[model samples]
Target chain A: MRAAIRSEWTKLWTTRTVWWALLGAFVLMAAAAGQNAIYVENGDVTTASVAVMSVTIAQLAFVALAMLVMTGEYSAGTIRATLSWIPSRGRLLSAKIAVVSAVTLVTGVAVGLLGGVIASAIVDDSGSIAGDAFKIGIYLVLLGALATGLGAALRGPVVTLVVLLMTIVVIPPLLQLPDIAVLNGIADAFPGVAGGHFLYGDADPYPPLVGLLILAGWAALAVAAGWQVLTRRDA
Target chain B: MSITLEKLTKRYGPTLAVDGLDLAVRPGRVTGFLGPNGAGKSTTMRMVLGLDRPTSGRALVGGRAYDSYKWPLREMGALLEAKAVHPGRTGRNHLLAMARSNAVPDRRVDEVLAVVGLTDVARRRSGTHSLGMGQRLGIAGALLADPPVLMLDEPVNGLDPDGVRWIRGLLRDLAAEGRTVFVSSHLLSEMQMTADHLVVIGHGKLLADAPMTEIMGGHATLEDAYYELTGSAA
Candidate 1:
């Protein structure tokens, strides 16, 4: 397991995709936070809120990074070599999840804290940092896990990105617009909604803990399905 | 070390890729795996490497399944296909990752790169490499762990004459050191020069398995024997 993790770490950094994704995420986070701080009414939001909102856009870059972690191997035909080396499908998937989660956790915290500083510098009324950075870190880790699983299951960047966009970006807004009980419930159940509730501290339907658990559940389910496909299918 | 296939069978949705193959490839000699296109040479090697699950029976390396070994790469090394690498990564980094996966020493990466004469170009992105360079990189990977068992699929696919000659000498030297070498290629003349034993299949079925001299008997050349064997099987 340790060897597999080491190999995965090396694999992730040896390519240009991870660095580009990270740079893009940081840039997006900074721009969004700065814009929100400058343009929005000072009393309408806090520095933490600005950081949280900024992450919604920046998280896409991290999701793309996570998806590529698995999809890249499939596209390059390197998965066969990888399997021949490690041979244990479950261990390899676990190593990938661990590596992706660790990197995204650090990236999310860094981006969140940096964005908060940018917002607080621009807006006088912006609130304190508090636990928002840590929350964003956790959210991004689960989100990264979810994307990695989807990448493994889908095995294509475009398809995985489309499905993730539809669920996390497109479908959630439409689902929330109806305001019906079932529609609201379904929207709340989605990982994006649950993540938002957790990050933005919305406790309407459930506590922040429940929101985190809901997103975690989705990630676990996706990873389980990915493991199934990975183990059963021929490389 | 030896590769033992026991009743190994693989079927892909009504297409039989390999049908009940049973053979033991021993160490101290080069075993040539030959077949026409779609004859399951690659599929059989994939099964041995645990890339593809066998539909029935098993492929054993050194008396156990490939995955069962704690350090499979150290037990067996393989080049399943040319350029089976992430194009964005440097060839050196690719080999380093493979080395780390099986706990092989980091220095071995440099050693293999030097052995394959890729030391100077190892830092460049593999995407920028020519087909011959890519084949060399793949061979470097297969030799990274210095395993007792080595399996290569169509290893000479994209090599120039010099690269081909280098590989033939490398295979001979490796097998001379008592490592089990299993190489698959359609070039019978090349195999005739390198292999001590031969395993031929046609349409997923074993057509011939014998020593090179024995199979070459009563035929003008290795190519004639191969055509006669596969042609009759077809």
Candidate 2:
């Protein structure tokens, strides 16, 4: 397991995708945070809110990064070589999840805190930088796990990205637009809504801990589905 | 190490890619796997490497399945296809990752690169490499772990004369060192020069499996013998 993790770490960093994706995430976070600072100036939002909102956009880049970790092997035909080396499908997936989660968590915290500081300075607003940064880190880690699982199950970057974007970015808002109670409840249960609830500390429908658990449940389900396909299907 | 196939079979939907193949490839010789296109050579090798599960029976390396080994690369190295690498990664990095997977020494990556004469381009992204260079990279990857068994599918596909000659010598030397070398190709004449044993299949069924001299009996050349065997099987 340790060897597999080291291999995955090497594989992830050896390519240019990880670096470019992290840079893209940071840039998007800075831009969104700057824009959100304008709302804080008008007393419409808090610095913590700006940080969370900025991460909501920047996390997409991390999603792409995580998905590519799996999809790239399929597209490049390196999966054959990889399986020959590791052989255990479960071990490979676990190693990938570990590496992706670690990288995203560390970088996500950095990006969130940096963006929060910049926004706070711009608006001269006092906010809990550490708390918001921790929240952003956890959210991105779980989201990264979800994307990695989808990538394994889908095995195509474009298809995985489309599915993730639709579910996380597109469908959740549309589901919330209707005033129906069932629809609202379904929307709240979605990973995107759950993530927002957890990050923003919304406690009406569910506590932040429950929100975190909901998102973690989604991640676990996705990873399980991916593992099922990976083990049963031929490379 | 020896590769043992016990009634190994594979079927894709309605198409039978490989049928009930029982053969033993021993060490200390280059065993050429020959067949026309779609004759199941790649499928059979994939099964042995655990890339594709056998529909029935078993394909084992040594006495166990390929995946049963903790470090399969260290047990059996293979070059299934050329350029089976990420385009954005350098060749050295690709080999390094493979080495790390099986806990092979990091220095082995540079050593194999040097062995395959790819030391200069090792740092370049594999996508920019020419066909011949890509083949060399794949061979370097297969040799990274210095395994006892080696399987190569159409290894000479995109090599120039020099590269081809280099590979022939390399295979001979590896086999001379008592490694089981299984190479697949449609070119009978090339195999005639390199292989001591030949395993021929057509339409997913074994047509011939014998020593080179025995299979070449009363034939003008290996190509003529191959045509006669595969032609009748077809």
Q: What CAPRI-style quality would you assign to candidate 1?
A: high
- Which ranges in model 1 have alpha carbons more than 4 Å from their true place? A42-48, B232-234
TM-score of chain A of each: 0.95, 0.96
List the candidate 2 regions with Cα displacement exceeding 4 Å. Answer: A46-48, B232-234
Please give the DockQ score of every candidate, comma-separated: 0.87, 0.87
Give lDDT tens digits, candidate 2, residues A1-235.
9999999999999999999999999999999888888888888865456888887789889999999999989988888888888899999999999999999999999999988887877877647789889889999999999999988899988999999999899988888887688898999999988999999898769998899999999999999989988888899
Residues B1-234 of candidate 2 have per-residue lDDT tens digits of: 899999999999999999999999999999999988999999999999998999999999999999999989888989988878888999999998899999999999999999999999989998899989999999998898889999999889899999999999999999999999999987778899999999999888989999999999999799989889889534
| Model 2 local distance difference test score | 0.91
Which clashing pairs does model 1 show?
none
